[model samples]
Target: MTRLDFELQFARGDFLLAATARIEAGVTGICGPSGAGKSTLLALLAGLLKPQSGHLHFDGDTLIDVRAGHFVPPWQRHFGLVFQDGQLFPHLSVRDNLLYGYKRLSPAQRRFELQAVVELLEIGALLARRPAQLSGGERQRVALGRALLYSPRLLLLDEPLSSLDERLKQQILPFLLRVKTETAIPMVYVSHAQAEVDYLADRVLTMADGQLQPSLATRDAASGLARGSAGL
Candidate 1:
């Protein structure tokens, strides 16, 4: 099993974050309420934020070592991020957005193809449309496609379904399931909703008030909920 070991400490204003975690392959679900440090954790993992003193090792490769003065940039880290809002470029067509990351790959480093990604996310019909023209689910699907096209080693999802309605969430759930089963790439899914974590995660981590803990005791908290009530 691939593993990510982290011991991080960071502070901003009056808030402080002190978290230690070991993430493994498959989905590692992060559950917490709105004010929790869930997003802060993701930002650290994605290299968007640097910890004052910390260590991060993924599969034995050191990504960050504060003592050693080492840090990898987000692009070089090969992490794909999908926010609640798709964040697709308003000026680009869906096809362009999906192909954007694919084009960034070196000629010899190509792993994921555009056609395969399009098919995987079922976004073939929305290729020519712009971001403003697509529905919420459609935009998210395109965002997912674009991220996959980057062929990231890890996928980071921060409430990807939070902005969608019930019907849209239902429509996108199958694709998310496919993302888990069909790809070997690991994922860190961050959401406040326990049901969503239950349906998708292999391991659970709970965050609260800038702290993180393994949810070993409450592992089934979300699993006990009905699928419809879980809301994806």
Candidate 2:
């Protein structure tokens, strides 16, 4: 019974994430238009950015309680983030990058094994290669591997495929589906692509102009209604 509850408020330049959400041990999608604060919410959860007024918690662990002026360290939180660009260490071999987090965990808690994840993401052949040798899709696969290696309490994926070409997206998306099916790790997949949301989300949250909107028929369909000239 994993749980996460968060409320955050902040502004960077012109974007803001005045949003709240709850995740109950399953995949949840965060969908929104560009500049709607989707990534901002993820940053808050990961403790990479703190809010002006808010609190974050996971199963009562107290990740952030700004009211008490307490903030937990990001690394200690075990938040696994996979960004759109797939930020792998350019200098390290794929194997080293994946093993980095594994080495940090005590023997008892390490759940992700290299052979399993490497096979799952089809990265066995890329292990010896540096970042410069792989395609965009392959790089993202390695990023996913690194995140899984951490054994995260929650996975924060910020529009991971947004930067890939359509051809590469085809190659990578099935692997993501495989990831979702094979791992119990709860994920917050951020995307503006309704198609991706439709295929991957168990639940969806839609954001626009820093505010979250609810949809009885799902956001992609509801958004269609809001955009149509026809009266509801």
Candidate 3:
């Protein structure tokens, strides 16, 4: 099982984050308005942003230790993150981009098979295409595929659907559902829309003013979505 144990306090310009959270194996949704520190939280967990006082651990591995002057770097943390913008390399083909980070893994440690990924993401047809040639949804899918191929212990999705229109979002939601159902890794999804949370069938963690609240108190399996469909 994956674990996230983090407590962070840091400031940048007018923004400050005093956030702590624990995530287990499954999708954990973080929903809040733009300034609620959604992306910041993800950055901290990814080791891109260091907290003045906090400890971050995944499973039994210590990712960050402030007291000992220790902070394992981002690449070593085994985190795969999808930024709001699809950060695929324009110079590389889809296949190459997906396999870019895969070379770091020893052959025995490569849990995700390449053919399985191509079939699951249906990226085979587009493998030869460059990033600049892809549609918004396609680029996002490629980005997702790339991150997944990296064999991350935990995945962080920062507003994966933020740039897409409603139709595009609808088109892509199923991919996310497939990710949730098929993969065993825990996902930390950051979003501004509650509807997206429900549509993807994730456990919701609402954020406000740079703090994460207790997880949602519902078990209907459809509670988060029911509220989303009603425009909550």
lDDT of each: 0.84, 0.81, 0.80
- Writing each residue's lDDT as its tens digit, candidate 1 over 1-232 gives 5467788988998888878876667788888899788889889998999999898888788999999999998888878998789899999999999988888889666678888888999899999999999999999999999988888888999899999988998899889989889877788899998988888887777788888876753454455321110112
Error of 3 at 27 (Å): 0.3
lDDT of 2 by residue, 1-232 (tens): 4388776787777666577665666567778889888888888889998888888889889988888999998889998999999999989999998888888999888888999999899899999999889888999999999999988878899999999998998888898888888888888888998778768777677778887654343544532322211122
Instruction: For candidate 3, give the lDDT of residue 39.
Output: 92
What TM-scores do the predictions have? 0.91, 0.90, 0.90
| Backbone clash count, each prediction separately | 0, 0, 0
Worst 10 residues of 1 by lDDT: 223-232
Quote the RMSD, in angstroms, for model 3: 4.8
Q: Which clashing pairs does model 1 show?
A: none
| Candidate 1 error regions (>4 Å) | 217-232
Candidate 3, 194: how far from true, in Å?
0.7
> Against the hidden true structure, what lDDT does model 1 obtain?
0.84
> Which pairs of residues collide in candidate 3?
none
